[model samples]
Target: MDFSHWLLLFCTLLAFYNLGIIWFGQIVVYPLFAKVGAEEYITYHTFYSSQIPLPVILPGFAHFLLPIALIFYRPEPVSLGLALANAACGLLSLVVTVALEIPRHNRLEKGGKQEDVIRELIRYNWPRTFSIMGSAFLTLMMLMQAFSPTI
Candidate 1:
């Protein structure tokens, strides 16, 4: 119930939540992009973008930062290494989101749902999705390690 503990709980919760989203996105959401009508695509994409920031961005950014904080404050080498891995994954996800996915979404908004673009988005998203799951695994490992008895 210290700061590091709080941060760990928050990061762990968020990481799992993001893992759920990642699966849903890869399996359901992104695939449906092609089905939206060209005229309505922008509106749909706009609404999606508008709504996702809170659930997605807030936790994601927090998760990214939490690991670094843990590294400094907790300083348990095993958990710290896991935290670093989580942070690295989180950072890569953010970079991919901003650099690749968002622009693709924007293009889809303007140009209307191109199959190629949609396919590209889906293709490009695999790394970020896997990264989030990896982060979740690391977060879980860190939490378990923190709670377990030390030999």
Candidate 2:
């Protein structure tokens, strides 16, 4: 329909897609990498260092922008609340990424003493994972509001 509508749909789709990435990364990918021993661990770290930032940066930026679009578009109050909640989740994701994840990733890439890096990665990753889940929830709520009867 309009920009806000399109933005909501896009945000919903992307958030869900991002959720899939986080889920797979946490459940399958990271665990697999973690089990591969030190050399493979280094390789996994390097690969993740090079590739993960792409997914993190763009979708992160989009996640931030979409909520602002919804706010600007001034949707219904229910829709606005849903959008704000979604945006807040994105903001939390950004905070966790900046405050925790990226720093750990940087340390992993630097090839230094990683005595606590894995532990920290495991710790910090959970909040980011939960934030994605929260975003998915909010996005679904927004979609419901977008489609549901205005009562």
Candidate 3:
């Protein structure tokens, strides 16, 4: 019914959506990169990187920003501690994506058939994935805490 409530709901939904994407990307998508033949891998990677679905891209960006927003806005159900933890996870995810994964992806785009990069991508993705999943859990907990009848 208010700005804080909306912020909490948006953050919760985005984090949950991101967690799903992370799990699917980790388990299904990233592993399959190795299967693509060397000749086609670069083309596929280029297309994949270029053509990220809007639904994925927008919310993905929001997931990165929403926690920071939550930290400043602090809804009734959302404690400062929870917001800080969520922000930490969001920041970690952003760092991992920009610093680690993006470079590795860039390398793969140029260095075709780099199995090492692919391996590294998969290996390094777990932290980002876990952080997203953790954010989702934290958001859900905040919601429960918000909605639960007061003692």
Candidate 4:
């Protein structure tokens, strides 16, 4: 009904959007990397890498800003601790992306379909996937708390 609520909704939407993408990557896409024949992997990976960034960067950039905004402008009933917790979940996703997952993606892109790399990609991906999932839940809870009228 107001700016804080809107902020929470937008942040929640971004978290859910990222949650869907990451889960799909976790459950379907990453594991399937090994099945692609080596010769075709580069091409497949190229296409995948190209297509992925828009989905990632658009929300990612806003996702970055929104959590910081949450820290400052959290709605009624969304405590400072809850806001910080939501931001931490977002931070975890970012740290995992910048530190772990991106390198593995680049390795697969450059080195072709190394099974070890794919396996590590899948293995390393669990944290980001679940954190975004956690982010989504945190945002939802924030919304419910903001909107609900007592008990």
Candidate 5:
């Protein structure tokens, strides 16, 4: 209802949104990178890279910032520790994305879908994927703790 409440809802929604997208990439999209034939791989990957930013970057950047906001504006029943944990998880995911995943993607983009690069993308993605999963879990816990009926 207030700022913190609104932030919690937004953060929770974003957490699950990120979780879904990352999981889909981990389970489906990244694996299929290997299947895109060498001939079409460049074209397909170029299109994929072009289209992905909208879905991936916007919510991801929002998710990154909202947790930091949560540290300052956590809703009722959400402790400072929980807020810090949420922020940490978001940071971990971002670090993994920037440090580990992006370079692999860059390699694939430049080299035109080398199997090693694709494999690294999938393998290096685990930390970010798991961090998102952790963020989702923490946000879910916060939501329940904040909104559960007083008994």
Candidate 6:
């Protein structure tokens, strides 16, 4: 398939993969840690704080690449629109990750107050969640356009 098509498919898979991170963090990982005593929670928090940068930086770089690729490919209107929308959502997620989440993670890493860290984490995570869902929706729309007889 064309580059636009390939980028769309790549984004769809990436968004779905991110959804797994969201689900696992929200449902399994956080809750388990949250249930532990405060000391344990703090320790867990500190560990994760150190680890967070790797995930964020890698995905942020990938987010940059995807949009550039979509723009370069220059698909037809319907496909292009869908790809652009998906790219926009990915950009939004990247912004939220860099602007909001990374700072919080950095603070936590530095030995900032736990309450503040947790609060920021909770606040910032929703946008990432929504962006992933938006990417999925846009991908579905693109697929329909791609396979539709009229298109």
TM accuracy, model 4: 0.93
Model 3 scores a C-alpha lDDT of 0.87
TM-score of each: 0.90, 0.83, 0.94, 0.93, 0.94, 0.74
What value does the lDDT take at residue 45 in candidate 2? 76
What is residue 7's positional error in candidate 6, in angstroms? Answer: 2.4
lDDT at 10 for candidate 1? 77
lDDT of 3 at 26: 96
Model 4 pairs whose backbones collide: none
What is the descending lDDT order? 5, 3, 4, 1, 2, 6
- lDDT per model, in order? 0.81, 0.73, 0.87, 0.85, 0.87, 0.66
TM-score of 6: 0.74
Alpha-carbon runs more than 4 Å astray in model 6: 30-46, 49-65
lDDT of the structure predicted as candidate 5: 0.87
Q: Give Cα distance to truth, residue 126, candidate 5, Å.
A: 0.7
Write model 4 residue lDDT over 28-142, tens digit each, in one string.
9998998999999998998998997788767865675578799888887888877898888888878888899889999999989999999999998898888888888888888
CA shift at 71, candidate 3, in angstroms? 1.4
Candidate 5 worst ten-residue window by lDDT: 104-113
Candidate with maximal lDDT = 5
What local lDDT does model 6 show for residue 32?
53
Candidate 5 per-residue lDDT, tens place, 77-105, comes to 88888888989999998888889888888
**Candidate 1 per-residue lDDT over residues 70-128, each given as its tens digit:** 66765253455676787888888888888988899889878876889999999999999
lDDT of 3 at 53: 58
Q: Each model's RMSD to truth, in Å?
A: 1.8, 2.5, 1.3, 1.6, 1.3, 3.2
Please report, as a residue range, the 10-residue window in candidate 1 with the lowest summed lDDT: 72-81
